[model samples]
Target: MTIRIGKIGYLNVLPIYHPLETGEIANDFSIVSGPPSALNQLMDAGRLDVSAASSIEYARHPDKYLLLPDIAIGSRGPVQSVLLLSRGPVDSLHGETIVVSAQTHTSAALLRVLLAEWKIRTNFVTGDATAILSRGERPQAILCIGDEALNLRFHPDYPVRTDLGEAWRTLTGMPFIFGVWIARRDSLDRSGQAVRRACDTLIRAKVWGQTNIASMCALAAERSCLSREELRSYFDGLVYDLGEAEKQGMTRFYRHLAEHGIIEDVPSLNFLA
Candidate 1:
């Protein structure tokens, strides 16, 4: 059986997918690339059998998916690719407006949660974040993630930017899981063994990539036009696996989501072996 795999095409994940690029894994599968949100749509639509999706996607629709054990895009603190850029301090957000990136549901919801918990009553304006550079929008703060976050990094003009993961830690004292590799329940039922094997392969790839950071940085530099040093900095700050801390954080996050009406219900967090 052929499996359709959806991946996020970003520099931060280039290393984890090295096996696929080097043919260490089978090429019989269909591969499609998009931002995490689009990949989630593909999986929900049955267009993809498995995908590396926004972790919150699986949390949002748990019955429909199975998390591949031992793997994820997570960070203990300071994820360089997800940032909250503000014109002023977060405490001064009482009557300000914030713009949110249109690419992700999880980050946007998380932003709202953090803002609400912090008692920052700001009106959020959602739109294409990339356009913020081209259009002079009316926003005191902006929530940007993924490639957009990478773009906004080190801009001398944006002096008050905070990493969202870091912000979460300061607010809730927990790590954040951004994305996970998940198999559709129906697809897993049809090809369980292959799915397991693929998950193992990807997990191994993640480990191997971590061990060979220099080479992975080189690959990322060539592909994404990011410097090796910058890519390394990004990888160094993020965790590549799903461990106990992430599980607990995810549980807390799901409860918050359910309480705040972001998701309809909360489901048990179970991993596929």
Candidate 2:
């Protein structure tokens, strides 16, 4: 049986994808790639055996999916890649419309929590950079995540930029996790030995990538249009290990989600053995 795997196609996932892209991982499985939201949808549909998904997606249905251990996309603060841009005073964005990137769920949820905490009221719409940049009347703000957020300049851009990761840390004093690897609960039980292969492969990729970040940053720089130093700094701020502190962060995040009535309840974190 051919094991299926899904990965985020954004630059932020390079460390996870580096080994896979370089053929360091065994080539026995089929790999699917897309934005985090797409991967979440595909995994929910059981079209993917394993995939990276927004952390909130897992929280919403933890009973249906098992987290792949020890790997995640997280930041303690100032995750330069997850940003909210505003053209006016941040406190004054209450009644305005904000264009949110369609590629993420956790970041979008985080934004909602932030707004609610600030007692700010706003409307949201799904949009990409092109749509936001070309609209007749500019959006009061735009929430950009992943690779798209790395390029700070959007055509006809807004003036203010807030790093959502930093905001979360300052507000809650916890690291914010954006993405995690997961698989259908039943899929992990089927034991095509597929999940085993995927887990080993991803762990290997992460190890290799972290060990060679400097070189990886240079290569990513060529494609991302950011200087190698900038890419290095960005990568430096990201944490791949889903350790104790991250688990706490996840718990706190879910609790906040429940408090805000964003989700039905805070699901327990479950993992595949």
Candidate 3:
């Protein structure tokens, strides 16, 4: 059976997916690409056997999925692609409206955590965050993630920009895990060998992609507004490994989420055996 793997269609994941797309690591897997939020929904519905989905997805439903070992999309500081742009200071936005992109979950939740920690109360509405700015209509703030954040990080209308990863690091002093690789538990139970084989292939692909980041940056440059050098620097700040520190970071984030009532409780990380 062909394993259906979910891929996040963003430059941040190019390093991991480039090899698979180029046949550098040959496989018979079927790959489905979408935004992180969409992939999370697909994984929850069992439409995807495995995916790189929002970390919150796993925290919310730990019983239904097993994490892939040693892989994640995270950052120690200043993840340039997850940002909050504000017309005024973030602390001053109490009771003001903030336009949040409908394409994210983890980042949006992280924003809420940060706001709560700062004792700031703000209204949130899901819509086209960019359109408000493009149309010269300034909301109190706007939240953007993935390529949209990268594109709007420097927009002049919002001078007060906060990088969510940077804020999380300042708050927790740990790496911020945005997305993680997960496999539906039932799929593994039914096709353990195929799932494991696909996992191994993914690990190999990650290793290759990390080593060939320059090539990946070249590919990203052609499609993005940033130059090759800028893309390299952006990728440099991203963390792909789920090591001890990354695990601790994830746990810390879960704790904050639980404290803010964003999640029921801090769920334990369960990896595929």
lDDT against the true structure, each candidate: 0.81, 0.86, 0.93
Cα deviation of 192, candidate 1, in Å: 2.0
Query: Estimated TM-score per prediction?
Result: 0.93, 0.95, 0.98
Candidate 2, residues 1-273, lDDT tens digits: the string is 677888888888887787786787655768899998998899888898888899998988888898888999999998988889888878989899888998889999999999999899999999896555656657778898887788754434577888999999999999989989887877878874778777878888888889989988998988977899989999999989899999999899999899999899988888877
Best by lDDT: 3
Ranking by lDDT: 3, 2, 1
Please state the error at residue 25 of candidate 2 in Å: 2.7
The prediction achieving the highest TM-score against the true structure is: 3
lDDT of 1 by residue, 1-273 (tens): 767888787776777776676776545667789988899899999899888998788987888998988788878889988888877788887888788877787888888778778877888777776676667654677788986788776665567888889888877798888888898988888899877777777788788778888888887777665788988888898888788888888888888888888888877987786
Residue pairs with colliding backbones in model 2 are none
RMSD of 1: 1.8
Deviating ranges (above 4 Å) for candidate 3: none
In terms of lDDT, the poorest run of 10 residues in model 2 is 150-159
- Pick the winner on lDDT between candidates 2 and 3: 3
